[model samples]
Target: MADDAARYLLGIDVGNTVIKAVLFDLEGRQVGSHAIDGQSTRPEPGHVERDLEELWRNASEAFRRCVADAGIEPGQIVAAGCAGHGNGLYLLDGDDRPLVGIQSLDTRAAALAEELAAEHGAALHAATLQEPWPSQTPVLLSWMRRHRPEVLEQAGTLVMCKDYITFKLTGRKVSDISDMSGAGLLRMPECGYDDELLALYGLQGLGHLLPDLIDPTDVAGTVTAEAAAATGLAEGMPVVGGLFDVIASALGSGVVEAGATSIIAGTWSVNQYVSSEPVIDRDLLMVSAFGPDRFMIMDNSATSASHLEWYVREFVERGGHHDDPFGFCHRRLAEVEPRLDDPYFHPFLYGSRLGAEHRAGFNGVAGWHGEGHLIRAVFEGVVFEHRRHVERLRAAGAVIDHATLSGGGARSEVWAQMLADCLGVPISVADGEETGALGAALSAGVGVGVFAGYEEAVSGMTRIRREFEPDPDMWAHYDHRYSTSRDLAEALQGFWSSQYRDARRENNGEEEAK
Candidate 1:
């Protein structure tokens, strides 16, 4: 009976902060998980990178540990899928060795993207249906050609994070439509690359760099002997083309149909929903979902649970292990109730959705404040951002009937209630924190015939673990605070831009002196 229950699906997520592997049964129960701490190095102030070999080594080790920890044999992993951070360039050599691995959080190409936006801005948006963010493949490749032409000259292919890992596993280079179609590279609504469109972004002659694109649930390939020996996966175990981390999380949360919404408050605050008709507008960003005629509309920012993580790691946590940092932080936040006079934190320690020019810090503070007050403010600020995203979705005519919350922020009861209150809607959360991996695992299931399709797989596997209903009394208080936070951002944007100009001038002076 134990062996009967042991037939499992393995899902791997190569996220920004962690490389995690999770094992789940067909019933959608997580059996075991193992994670390796992932860190991206900042070579320059804006550049975020990882050593490719080091990333592979850590990811493979975590895969091995996950299987071992689950006490399952390698043969039990019938099928597997990968969910990874989207839109970063992972350059591969002709020999299949990694040349460069850039993270989605990278901003090294920001200036180049800005420079070309004038001539190609409309072209980019029309082709990809996405604003060319700094880490889009073309923008990053453009920066490389200018600063390091040799890197582009020797290149064979460009792939995202999960696609690279799939290559390492199966000796095949392929990507799902979900990653490719939205990166300002593929001509969207029509699903191929165009040389004329490539020329618009200075990528005219390098169209061959695009990988073979496939459906997210198609069999990408089977694991190789070399990969099996390293990670304890079966040599012939099938691997499926996977999805963007956000989409995987959406599927894992059972947001498979229209009117179902998902909010992932991980390193980014992602609020999105699947739509039969794509919503193209300024306030929202979109990507192809898993299938044809489907799109995922998202309003996201770097301002989310990472701020909570920063507060705990930098301030509350001691040098060694602390058992419950989140619990401790929640208790501290509980001390300070949500009041009219509380300080407002921008929570933009990372880049902001409000335009990159706006900086993040405490706008209002006083002598009466304490760490608890700051914690409360951070929680409120992150939820306020969630409210902003849902508002954008609503503005685009989304109903948002079922809003599911996932990620680090959902772990906090206090924060979940705050989000519910701020959004004025009842939100549901599922049992597993590894929803991204679980979503991948479900894709694996469909690939190997364990389920019929997403509709069947999601219904069979997912169940709502908890639900938070809005508190009527707190809505007015939060409404006032959220508006104040927005006002503060408007007031501070020009000052932050001026500060940036001053710093850039000082750096230019230093360089010219040399």
Candidate 2:
């Protein structure tokens, strides 16, 4: 390769709300960045989708803008990689035409998930190391088989968001191990498809729909001429297979070592820990394949900053005097006293696994309390939710010494300090703003032999921006508050379970009627 070609690597991150692309030099310093805003299509109450053509177009535009900003010729780029949201299903016909984009958040497959769990009990769990969930591939596929059989019957290939984009660029129908593991098909220890799961789900012949699994740093293929023309990149540029967004974020935040934990506070907050082996707790959840070895244990809270954003928009609409609502809220929170009398709020705007039936509200509010009290209550409630996840991880035998926090939410000093106090662990912010893109670039560097290993690459690139240490007095107060929150969450678990069952039954009855 020419010297100019060896100087730059392109990284693309496909998120639910937007697609981000970054241009990095050989030294891993970000040279240029671009983003394209996109929204998920919600045709019905529970369905979500994106136009595959538009997704590709937006990604291509992002690449063009970033490359232009860098002032580099397209042919100067060396290797490229892509990362994306996991567990979303995208179907393609034999000619690579998109059938549909299955939204990951849609819970139409809940009944199918339960059915798979019932039919394949311990064996299935041992194989996949994951209980059947509505978001899993098997359950989603089962839902399609029953609801939209025509789409499944005609689908010649099944892939996730990143796989589809990679195939569009490289003309290879393949998936990386990280993406495959999230699909509820790959056997955990074996690191391949679980035939028992396939048979149990009546998908024995659906193997063709899956992709060839490759290592996270493997060279999947080179970009084709067609892709090159469309994206304004040189032909034959190497494309590395990158991991899912969670793993990429972990890598970018420098949490590669065992026992190192991170909280990626995006629209949803995912707490992750790298483990030498899979740590299973019936209560805590997992999104594995994040570590280099067997498993990277993870659990997620559906609402985090998104909930905060909602509250800010609803409550602080007219009070826009100084800065952004979030900034204003932070300023207000710092002035208020830490302890409140009787205004405890549950930050469950979209409902939570803890209590789906309960509507979010403040337990006590009076004329004395104003917007500041309400905002602080919401912020504290979110931090308490993080505490719940931390307790769950500890119970599952993962010793989390400290946590590296990243994402848009981590930028707030007040939120970071609140998290530290609530979890009683030191919290630090990641070095860069685009950690996900940086992580994908690091994976590509490893694939192309730019670095010796994952460790060396991260050590040379990742940095910490700010650190928050827990306050003893605040920690003591949060400890009691967290205990109360857990008790409340547990008290509603049975009610939520029943509500879930009833909703599933109602949906199934509607389907049967049709």
Candidate-wise lDDT, in order:
0.83, 0.77
- In candidate 1, which residue ranges exceed 4 Å CA deviation? 1-4, 318-323, 503-514
Cand. 2 Cα-lDDT: 0.77
Q: After best superposition, candidate 2 residue 362: deviation in angstroms?
A: 4.5
Off by over 4 Å in 2: 1-6, 290-294, 312-323, 347-362, 490-513
Per-residue alpha-carbon lDDT of candidate 1 for residues 1-514, written as tens digits (9 for 90 to 100): 5754768999999887688899998899888789998778986656788877877888789889898888888899899999998877889977778888888777667657777776787777777776666777788888787777888888898988999889989999999888777566777777677998888788878888888989899999999999988888889999999988889988998888876899998888999888886677755665565687778888787789989888888877868466888888777887876679898988877557665555668757889998888888888888988898889889978887558998878778888888888888898987888889999999899888889998899998888889999999999999999999998888988898886677556645753574
Question: Candidate 1 at 61: error in angstroms?
Answer: 1.3
Candidate 1, residue 498: how far the Cα is off, in Å = 1.7
Tell me, by lDDT, which candidate is best: 1
| lDDT per residue as tens, model 2, 1-514 | 3664457878889886688889887666789899998767876444567888888888888888898998988877878888887886788987889887875655556557667778775566666766666666777887788788887889998888888778989999888888777666787765787666687666877888888888878999999999988888789999988888878888888878888998977765678888777765656555577445646787765556767777766776656654587877877776778663636777665455443344455756777777678787787787776767777788878787799988777878888898988887899898788888888888888889888888887887788888899887887788777777656666766766686677667766877887
lDDT for 16 in candidate 1 is 79
Q: Give the per-residue Cα lDDT of candidate 2 at 284.
A: 56
TM-score computed on alpha carbons, candidate 2: 0.91
Backbone clash count, each prediction separately: 0, 0
